[model samples]
Target: SADIIWQHCTVVLISPASALCETFNIKMPPNINVLRGSCVTIPCSFDVESRFEKYLDHTCKAYWSDSPSFTSGNAKVKPTKDMTGDLTKKDCTTTFNNTRLLPGKKYYLRLECKNDLKYTFKQASVNISVIGTLTCSAPAPCWSHPPALTWIPNRGQSQETLQENQDKTKVKTSVMNFTASHLHHGNKISCTAVYQKNRGSPDVTAETSLTPDISYSPKNVTVSVSPSGPVPENSNVSLTCSSNANPAVRNYTWYRADGDQEALIGTGQSFIVTVSKVKSTFFCKATNALGCERSRNLQIDFQCNETQEGQRLPQRFKTINEEESSKPKSTTQLLRIS
Candidate 1:
């Protein structure tokens, strides 16, 4: 399910060519979101003149440029070999190492045919921007599917071309999906486009990142008691409540339930009390930003008849009437003594 959800992507395709010779089209997302230290797959596709179809030996070359024409001094090129698959086909998708991209820079895609004609399309190019080095707050939410827990890709993968829109525009796309865990929280994810002008020249890239928004409620709520088992009457007892949560629980409360109603007894993670009652039942509530959870009820009995020396006392103590009648030299006590 995570894999299926992670495979989701929103693609926008370039408008179809009005003329047969004007067959160059680049389809990609206007912007990309990525995590830091991760690789990015740029979905790309193109078409060429029918005449060039005969030149199977000719391969399509991809590049990035700061200028629209890609003739600027800062232009970076990616050779045909680095491209994901045979660029002579309709798909020209590529993968870029995000580490090579600089943040806050805008780049454009340039396509060229390596042949005697030296065909290069400058009339239309796609713009790419590199944003964020760490933590993306808002990632694109999936509309067709729920959010997925996945990891970034480490190696390059194959490309998939799908038809988009009512006109069935062929769009090339690459997917990188993995299982997401707590370790990925607050980390950056980036999608980068890599380009190189020549074998000896330096490579250039564009990328962006996002901080994942993970949400969960309190869980594993539990209550622990100190000096466990059969508490002595009037002795001090301690109770601690604990739970796990994403935002961290901010408040903890203790409650006592006797009969008809439950009453709040204390606040915080620890509750201390003098055990005077014969029996008592308590539970704790842990609250966080997401939600709250209550622990299971804990019952304690404080009627143990053990002496300081750990010996059991007699079951019967002086009755109320017997102790009152024998207290002083009252008439009844005097007559009984006489």
Candidate 2:
């Protein structure tokens, strides 16, 4: 009678034919780390006794078990859907797809053959460690084209190993690439590696994620005035400049349109001025590392009142034609009733 014994975290059957049992061997990585929601590959291989080898020639199955007993009745058993192993060749390479493996959990590998002896191996297992996804590399600055987003492999880095045996087992790597834009900022990009231990078995996967760092210049520039209506002569008014930008605007320059020339009036996001009898056109330039954007010209009208002291107050003001005002003007004179 064969007696089941647990030793070194492995389940083994000791029987009179225990010498033949020594021929069986299983090889796999001790542990693997994967990104959540991604795929992973498990490199696996095994050898069986010559007599039992015939049993594995057909109708053989592979699976992952939560227990070392390798019992099929165990509810914790997970079957691989994508097993690449060939019993004829004695290869047991397998892949797991989109595996959401839990962190700090161990999953064991098991094999079953459809023979009278009901051969099962539960001595080999691999631990699964779930970790945070990787982020996309920092965006490179671009003036004419969008930046390229490159994928960085896990901390362990992507690598492949070849196993030398009667049947050769090979491991492969996964990669992805894309272009990034401002719209993709803060968006998560993921990479997954899938692994299988045998044919028809469920897939196991490891995944990681990255957030794109997209840079862009200011857009939709506009200027706002504190007083909504016509400005009274000598009244103080405030002008605010605003725009949309990534990495934020580094500087805001206020400008006053004199005839056709724009004169830098102040530096900052806001400007203050005392209204004169003359109407004036104002605009602002917003700048950042990427580039600069100018706001649409704003026209401020100055209204005046005639005083009993014989001071003539202008009743209305007109903006100079932008086409004609493009030339530099040395003086801006308001209408006066002499």
Q: In lDDT terms, which candidate is top?
A: 2
lDDT of 2 at 113: 59
Candidate 2 lDDT over 11-110, as tens digits, reads: 1111111112357777776545444345666676778777765676566667665445545556254545345577556676766666533322345556
Evaluated at residue 261, the lDDT of candidate 1 is: 74
Scanning candidate 2 in windows of ten residues, the lowest lDDT window is: 9-18
Per-residue error (Å), model 2, residue 288: 2.4
Stretches of candidate 2 off by over 4 Å are 1-179, 190-207, 229-231, 303-338
lDDT of 1 by residue, 86-167 (tens): 6667565666664334332234655555554234455444443222112111122233321222224332233332324455
Weakest 10 consecutive residues of candidate 1 by summed lDDT: 329-338
Let me know the TM-score candidate 1 reaches against the reference structure.
Answer: 0.34
Q: Each model's C-alpha lDDT?
A: 0.49, 0.51
